[model samples]
Each structure stands twice: as structure tokens, then as C-alpha cells.
Target: MSETQMPAGQLSGNVLFYSKPEPLAKELHSKIGVKRMDGPFKFAKVGHAIPLTVGEFPLAAVTGPIIFVGDEKLPIAVMGLNAGENMFVKDDGTFESGIYIPAYVRRYPFVFANDEQNNQMVLCIDRNAEFIVDKGYDMAFFEANGEPTEYTKNCIEFCNNFEVERQRTVSFVQILKDLDLFETKEATFTPANPDGTQGETQKIAEYFGVSEEKLNALPAAKFVELRDNGALGQIYAHMHSLVGWDRMIALALTKAAAQQPQAANA
Candidate 1:
């Protein structure tokens, strides 16, 4: 199975990769740690979209297009053209090397859960993560004295940074929403006909994007505010990332061509 074995009746919240998340505690997990595992990222193989922070737009833009989705206008990095297909992730579960990987994916197996009553965030881990293991494994969660190990502290700090970026993304989205800059858009592709004629354009996805018309139409004062606050750069990053749609289409065609022979054999 591609997905993790989550606990029955457990709410998954928003993260698609996490399953069986548990609060990390020295008492409960004194021996728990992470180690290199074959197919460590296989759980993410079927996921085409991952949450993106505003901080990631520039780097993520180069790899794949970023789009806003749903009423929330949540930003996501588009990694594949269809469901259950991640072009960047090899069959062995290792994401393609020499390409930008989102912090959302790198921080996996560790996440934060809000302690609602305490008004605090608690560090949690996917109890069923393939890398999680007993003692003698790499990157132990705690030292013998019960303090968090350096590795664990680093992971926690990374999660904390992600939370900060995530909050910043919320503000960015709010600004776009207040400016009414969003436009509904569709991803389309036209395949070449066997006779070398132009084919009808096929729509692949429907999503929300920053409307260039709306952006250019903004009041001068509003445009200045966006630039002064650095949102303009991120907006441009997102817009530039739109070109990655063509890259995705190319990868999809390549993968499809490779599969045809296997299908014929079967």
C-alpha cells in the first residue's frame, strides 16, 4: 500500500504524509529515533500537491508551478499532472536529486500539533513513519539525560521555522484576497496529431491564480505597499512558476510513453 497505516478514527488534519502522529515525549519515546530506510518517502508517491509557504515560492517555483486552491486559497506546489503520480519521486521513493524539495516534504515524519487548551504547539511525529525506529538507530530523539538530542532539536527547530513561514504565507494570501487579485484559471494542453496537425486543447486542472490584469490595475498606493512589504517578489515568483506547467506536461508525456510498452507486454 502507498499510504501509511494510520490509527482507526484518527483525524489526519491537513498533512497528507503523516499517519499515526503522536506527541514526542522522553518518557514515551526514550528510544525512538530515525534512520535511513529504503523507500523512506514512498508514502508521498501518490501525492501530487504539497502545502507551500510564501518563503518557498522562489525556490519551489523553479521546480513546479505553485497554485492557490479552494476557498482557503492555500498555496500548493504542483508536482504531477494526474492523481497518484509524482514525477519527481522515483519508484524507489527517493525524490529526484539536484532539484528543490519543499520544506513541507523535508520536515516530514515530524510535525507540530496545537495543544488547544494550553494554547501551545506540541512537537509530534508519525509513529508509523518508515524511518522511525528503536534505539541504535540514527538521529535519536533524546539523550540519556532526557534532553532532546541535537538531531531532534534540529528537527524541532526546522518544524518551528516551517510554522513561522506557514503563518507568513497566511498573511500573503490575505493580502491577495483583500486586493481581489485572484482569478480562476485552467491548465490546458494541446497534443500533436499523428498527421502533424494542431489538436484540440485539453484542460487538465482548474485552479486560482493571481490575475495579472487585476495586479496591474491595483491602485498605485496598493502596488507600493505590496512592493514595500516584499509580497510583490513572491507574487512574481508564483507567476513565473506558471511556466512549469509545460514542464509537467513534458514529464507526463515521457512517463506515459514509457508505460505503453509495459502495458503492451501485460
Candidate 2:
């Protein structure tokens, strides 16, 4: 498909950390010199469901609800309830102050790519990123000797660390799946009408989450095994993160009201 036709989570081939990623080459690097990030999140548009690693559950739990996305059960931070809207992002493009920022968002503009032919990972940058600058910048991808600059080295290191955490998250999700701990869940929202009456209940989303009943029914030895393996904490963290679902609904309601022409006129 063409770049414009790419779905959410998928970006142009040159965009790293996107669902479809292409290698960052020296040629592209030359064109995009050391540009500093322009806005708080010019790269991230509305409705971007950022993938969360196992290490991020604690902080992410406080910022937003963490839930499984497709059949593979990939965990994601819910940034918006509806399509094409990010409630956490202000009109100035800055994220809400004091909210816990997920590592997935912090590692942006840099990512690791799988080099299948060489059986290795390659550090890459999004050539189309808003932060890229061709000249008059403090950072450079390569020095005069063609060696990577310190800035490039730091980005590579962060991408490598994120990759390691991503792999660990895969293992964590696999264990949950093997134990049959996940179940379908739904989040509902009921808005209050202007007349002081309850509005119709709306089911905003359906996702997969840890089954509390199954977790409680696990054998004592199995529970001990999970605790020993450090999976129990992650599970509880995910469960606790559900508390943010209501918060998400409230934000979504506020956004909806703000967008309504009638409300705007009032």
C-alpha cells in the first residue's frame, strides 16, 4: 500500500518505531543532519496506541490503562478513546504535565531494525521525523572521520535497551498466554445529560486482560512459581492499571464536549 493508505501504527517505510520500518542509511542520514526535536511530540499524531514493555507497567499504570491489543495480545497504552484524537496532548502539542511518560514514547525518533539477511539488528532513525535537520544543528549523525557522533551513539544505546525490554515483554506475555490467564474485557462509559439524567451506557472498547477468576484459582504451587519468576507483580500491576479506564472515559467525554458546536457556542 501507499504511504497515505498505511493504517494507524503503520507509517511510511522510512519511519522507524512504526509497524513497517526500513533501514536508515548513510545517504538518508546525510540529508537529515542533526535536527533537534521541534515540539513535545510532533512525530506522534492523534490516536497512536503506543506499545508498552514489561518494564513500563508500573509507571504506565499510573498514566493510563494498559491493555492487550490484537490476537497476539500485544500490550499498548491507550492514548485516546476514539480515532484521531489524543486527549493527553494539548493544543500546543505538549503532553499533559506530570503524567508518566511511557518509555515507548521517550524512545521515539530512534529504533532497532531486524537485518534478516545479516541475522542482526541495526540502529535506525526516522528520516521523515520532524526533529531531523540538515544543517545548523548541535548534533551530527557522523563526524568528519565518518564515525558516529556521541548523540548517535546515545540514540543507538537507548534503542538497544528498548529492544531488550521488548523481548522480555514478549516472554512475559507468552507466559500469561500459556497459563490461560487472559480474557475478553469491555470498558463502558455513561455520560450525564444536561437535564441531570444518566445518558445511555456506551461500550467504548473491548480488549483482553488478565482473568481475575483464573488467577485466583491457580494452584498454590503455580502461584509460587509465578512469584518466583517475577510475573506476579506484572500481573497485579496490569490489573491495578484498570483504574485508569474511568479516567480515560472522563477525558474522552471532555474532549467530545469540547468538540461539540453547541457546547462551543454555549
Candidate 3:
């Protein structure tokens, strides 16, 4: 399909892209980077839930055209893994090639819309129009011809299994929490840094009814590495930094176990 271009006024969808910096808010510059607003465009819509899910599991979604005054050519289903569903460019406004969303997000129920707010979108394209149809929902790199590009064996496989692990781990958390295996408790685990900044460990411990000491004692970072060799690990880190430790740890294990090979080189 020839790309459809809508006037700035007609752009509308459920996604929220970050554009401006609120000085009064606690802004973490290094982690969130600078939120760059579209230079001069004006938005028609005022209130909408940021179309991002707060869960640790990554979902199928699309981001960007990084619109200016006109419709810009953007890549389709260009496959990335665990990149935030909320779109943001690098500090320099460059695309972070590592971000990939799911094919279902790209193909159905239309997760996309655009406006001057952030002048960005999360789109829902038609099934036949998607590029990664054959690749299942795992995010990966594809060429113009729609073939998986070469990478380290584990990297390719990891991308291939991204969604599977995400779904599995998220489901596990829901089940365990529902079954009361993981209880919620008030915790002091989330502690302030030497400078008084709060850390996620305490929050995470509280969420899981454990002590921050107990949480810190778990081999979480190591297990995360074992699960996906660090793909899911970094995302969990991002979730922790922005969301909290409970989500980071939960998501890490989710992504890892979903991708765990049925049997290793035993």
C-alpha cells in the first residue's frame, strides 16, 4: 500500500509520545534522556492515556514517523526487542535501532495515531502490509527483502524468542500473584541512596513482601543474564529505573524463561 499521509489535524490514536520537559517534576536526565517536543507543531488533542502498558512484558506496537510539517517515511515492523512502547529519540533525536515491537501491534486493532503533542505515533497496520509476518512475534532485524539478518547465533535466537519469553514470564507473575505465592508487604527495601535518592530495591521488596535485604540477596542479575544473555536484562533495568524493581525482576524472569531452550547442551 502506498503510505497514507494525514494532515496534522487528522492524526489521532491512543499512543502518547514524550515531547516536553517539566521543570518542577523529578526529571532523570540520564535515564529518560531529554524529552524533545516537536519544534513548532500544535496538537489538537489534550488528554489521552500514554498508550504504554505499565507491565514488564513487551507487546506488539509501532512507533514514529517523528513528524515535522509533513508525513515522513518511516520503517514498518522493523523489528526490535523490549524497546519502550513509549517512543523517544536519542538525546540527539536519532532513532535507537534497538527498539522493536510486535507484529500483532503493527497489524491489528490499530494502535497508531499522530498529533502535534509529541508528533509521533504507535500504528496498527494491516496484516498483509506487515514485514515480519513470517517471524512470529519475536522482534528481529530484517532486510528490505524480509529475511532475518545475520547476527550472533544467540542474538538471532534471542530476538526470535523475545515475545515468547515476555508472554511466559508475564503470565507466570500474574498466576503466582493470583495464587498468593508472591505476597505484597510494606517494605523498607526501597532505600534512599547516600544522596537521598530512592532506589527500586525497597519498592520491589515491598511489592513482593520481602525485605530489601532479601531482594538484594537474590541472584536476580545473574539469573537475568542466564535467561537471555542480557537482552531482557537491559529492559528490566529500564523498567526498574522508570517503573520499579518488582517489574524489572518480574519482566527479566519472564523474558528469560520463555526463551529457555527445552534442553541445554547437557
Runs of candidate 1 with Cα error greater than 4 angstroms are 1-14
The residue ranges of model 3 lying beyond 4 angstroms of the native Cα positions read 1-160, 189-206, 209-266
TM-score-wise, the better of 1 and 2 is: 1
Task: Residues 1-266, candidate 2: write the lDDT tens digits.
Answer: 01112122332233324543435555445444655544557445564577889988988899788999798899988877876666677766578887766777777667765554445556555555555678677688777766667877787778878888999999999999999999999998887899999999989889999999999999999999999999999999899999898988877667676779877687
Summarize candidate 3's per-residue lDDT along 17-94 as a digit string, tens digits: 223212111111112111123321112122111221213233312231110011111112211123432232333323
Candidate 1, residues 11-98, lDDT tens digits: the string is: 3365678767777888777888888776677877877988899999999999989999999999999998888777888888888885
What are the runs in model 2 whose C-alpha is more than 4 Å off? Answer: 1-22, 259-266
- Cα deviation in Å at residue 77, candidate 1? 0.4
RMSD of 3: 19.9
lDDT scores of the candidates, listed in order:
0.86, 0.74, 0.31
CA displacement after TM-score superposition, residue 67 of candidate 1 (Å): 0.3
What count of clashes does model 3 give? 9
lDDT of 1: 0.86
Q: Tell me the lDDT of model 2 at 150.
A: 81
For candidate 2, list the clashing residue pairs, or say none: 35-133
